[model samples]
Target: MLVELVGQSGRDLDNVSANPARLVNVYAERTTEGERVLKSVLGMDRHTQLDGVFVRAMGRVDGVTYAVCGGHLWRINLHGSANDLGAVDTGRATLCGNNGYVCVQAGTRYFVYDPDADTITEPAAGAFSDIGSVEFFGNYTVITEAGGRRFQWSALADPTDLPGLNFSTADGKDDNLLRGLAMDGRLYLFKQESTELWYNTGEAGADAMARVAGGVWDIGLLSRDMLCQFEGGAFIVGSDNRAHLVSSGGFQPVSIPPVETAIKIDRPQACLTYSDEGHTFCAIIFKDSPAWVYDLSMNEWHERAEGVNLGPWNVAASCKIGKEWAVGRNNGEISILRRTNADGSTPLVREITSRTLRMDGQRTILREFEVFPRQGFSAGTMNLHISRDGGSTWTPPKPKPIGGQGEYGRRVLWRNLGQARAINAKLRWTEPRDICLSTQARIVT
Candidate 1:
């Protein structure tokens, strides 16, 4: 009997013990290169560090990028210049640009920055205290207070001032305390049990400003910083621990069971979401758990682990700067997600396992193992490990030389492999190149 496995996908680390056949990785994916290594933007350099702490908020004003770490702010230019702007607030902060100013909110306090003057000022503290999150809806600065049930927008095109004491409340039964985001000219409100969208009234004054569209509060958002925009819509980790795609029509679960099983429920606040254009996937990362990546192109799931790749992404904050993704790690370093190797030293790790092969309760003998690689890209070496008796143990890895760059249409074969009732095979590599592997197994009962 011959069994072939190609394009390994669908990873559920929570169920790996029971389902080891899925192609999963610490930091790898299946592209034209069977098991290609995933890349980070760039190395952790001085540009990503601020006051010995990782950036907590990243935003852009005019053409300048700003990174906030602790209470200090740094102005970053396109030419890679980082200038300290002294100290400001404490703890984690959120930033957004409204009109010509950068609006920053840390805790219940607020600070506004004028990009042209390079100055920061506090708004007159009267209205809009206890704000939880701030995002822009059209030209208005939309805000949600600490508790749910109500949200408001600032005066048109303004972030420092609001229109009187105007506020709008969600009349839905599930409008409990949560977060919000502004996208596509609508304000998305998330709660524990439901989600709601509000559109602009264009009134310019009081009377609750905006109203919730009927029947859109069907699903809710989980994880505060876990909202990221995708090609068709935005993806969020639902309060139910599932991944959802929120578009104009509402949301639907895009996460598989394995993706759902890997979330760290206890540390929900520590989760971060980002879209990787290189791999074309949306990654949901948790500090205490391995990353669960959803391939946007294939709509599939894969896993990423630090132990798999020498240094996987454990980012605290991430944003798309220009065309690439810039992220700040917990260790006080800034890195970019790129196709090249990190600092030319980080090793890439990949692992692909085949589905269990059963001989219908009859003992079998394995004769040979073969692997096929896609042509054209640079290739290195892969080690093979075989397991009999239901993947409980794997044989010592045997060395296999992979085809190098320009070695097109290459195939590797290993002969004289022993067999049992059930068996699985694994392929692993640790190089800074691509590995698109397709495997074939020969067995006899």
Candidate 2:
């Protein structure tokens, strides 16, 4: 957490308070790209791998943290340091590059994260479903329309225009489908059809993009069913069903499992890269399930996802990066993964403590007050009854300023000042609870 001091009304502070949020040191395994995610979650038992995200970080995922269990934007860091216009939890995240961008979903809200100076400012929402997949295709940033029908982001003409898909309109269907988009520096949208559409991020709408040639299926083993990129090019994943390949050349059928044997993959992302030592693969998280990594090089399947003393299914999955990676379950633990030497040998997963909520609503003044009716006043209503000046004059209570904070102690918010009597008053209160008052404390002013 960064610390700073502001002049109170233009004058220097007599002595700036030293109490501030702490930034614990942490580590995360370096991806093939050599990016180190914050792995502050050390020794936090386990809460089960339940939910994750991959977005540029702007740090500050504070505010009403969106990380509540079953919470959507729990670990979404599609931002940087600037307190986004609303509530975006991103800090110290690495996106592709200046041209490359990241997308995220916090609850029903979806936006992008730019890593320049720590700022988030897009408030694009109002969709049927949460944003599913976001990719920077050749010339545009293409995003799946989320749960329901969605027009292309281009429709809004925001600089972050998302590419349009051929599969669905604003009416989404069978879209449990995922999108693999990247710019060869050119516009490209890859779905199953193999007919790769070349799109322009520069253009305003879907009609602007044009489908280029079909070299995408030309290279090695690849199919629309699964596509993953390695050092050279992308490879279509080995399927539990009939297999096929997509390369720089075109499409070619390969040998593998039959279509009927295909199982609903809990892993939503495309496994792009992996390491032999730890047998861990890079894959995007889907349905909050553990990330799947096949040790093809070592003939093993390893799970680098987060887990805890809680139920494995507590959250759907835990294979994710960023701040919210380890936040979930009864223990409320958080964890980040780190590489041992390099080859990913049993990637070290550690827990990080959450920043204590340093500041809170002002300590309830927990004050008690007592009062009594002047010499002759009775029980019912009394006109001008009591006064600070020895009861020389009676002053009625001002109903407007009542109920603010801890007014005369009855936990002010709970006290019915309007129904109070014009007599003396007495009130008492405690912490973590409300205030109480007796007949003696019931007063008008």
Candidate 3:
């Protein structure tokens, strides 16, 4: 499950997890006061899906939690609730308000969006081919791709002109598949083709892998080196053709076992993600099915729970938040899992019922729907609510105006608000009095 977003464009995290939990813990940042708080949950419900193997995050726009999957040249932000924020469609990528463009693949292209007005524009950018992934670091956006080609986006360039990237990694040739990057503040690169893993010194044909483990091709980037999972060394491959950390750092080597028990591989490339508690998670293919969570501290591999299986996904994206993880499949299946127990054995998996109801690139066409009565509108006020789960429930939250002033409804701000899948509520205000209740129905997951 690829959870977090990758690439040079779109959104990333500002701070790392500060608090730790016995089973799992997460930090709650108070946007109103700008303070990040921490909390620990007893056990996760098996009914809720909270698994993410890619690099998605539990984000908040105006205190709303969202599930986002990002990769490729530029990261994508799925607005609204986790259930509704579908995968960032490749060709369906649209532009929204302020005429600001999303610089992907390290500034190779800029996809501009005007959400308020509902429009998407791709500014001609020559940076596309060379760009891999982009993300906003402190002041600049960091970009990387399968080759680990790193760069930054510059605003000085013409809006139509490609963003000037500031950095480069000549060592792009070091890793063949470019499995992992920047683990423990140091970039970890690996190419399954290599006989000896090499490290990148910013040059080609360098030692891209560390002597971390044997028969290793998968790598995950944790906050710092102190955090990360090792297969002690048992690893697995998922149906998505991605790799997972099935076991922890210390495991007795077992024979390849039977070809039936384990799956075969040609270029067995996989990815890993972390739980909100920083627990390492790996999803790999096993006997054709993509069985995941090989080594969750709860049960030792041999004695631990076998965990769940991910259906076929040509390209799967994942990310983690506390004990929860999310897996977004290309087939339009998003399985959210929570670590019910300390170990990965028992997990709470839930399929999202909500899908993309409507996506209008043109605003006038969207506003055409009169704000008046309809078949679904016999009650007081009906706010359109989206879910990360499979459209099972709906709750509209209070609307926070931009700049804290109740005047204008900024597009960028609403777009950002939509990122919080849990809190991003679509208000159905038949009367002004009903607006306050919107926040009361926010989904905390």
How far off is residue 307 in model 1, in Å? 4.3
What is candidate 1's TM-score against the reference?
0.86
Best by TM-score: 1
TM-score of 2: 0.37
Q: Model 3, stretches more than 4 Å misplaced?
A: 1-130, 135-138, 145-162, 165-167, 172-180, 186-263, 266-280, 285-287, 296-315, 320-323, 338-445
Report how far residue 416 has shifted in candidate 1, in Å. Answer: 1.9
Backbone collision tally, model 1: 13
| Per-residue lDDT of model 2, residues 328-431, tens digit only | 23222333333221111222222121111222333222122222212221112111122222222334432211233323332222233222212221111111
lDDT of 2: 0.30
lDDT of each: 0.64, 0.30, 0.29
The estimated TM-scores of all candidates read 0.86, 0.37, 0.36
Model 1, position 29, has a per-residue lDDT of 43
> Which 10-residue span in candidate 3 carries the lowest summed lDDT?
4-13
Tens digits of lDDT, candidate 1, 1-445: 5566433354345555465765444334445756343322222233455555756777777655777776777676555556777566766667788877887766666777777787887766435477676676677777776665767667777677765466777667655646767766677777767877777777665553565647456667675566666555787888788888788757878877766666644243334445554445667776566566676655566655554443344667666666566666666566666554333255546667777776688777777777665545776777888887546678998987777777786767777887677777887776666455545544444
Minimum summed lDDT over a 10-residue window in model 2 is located at 3-12
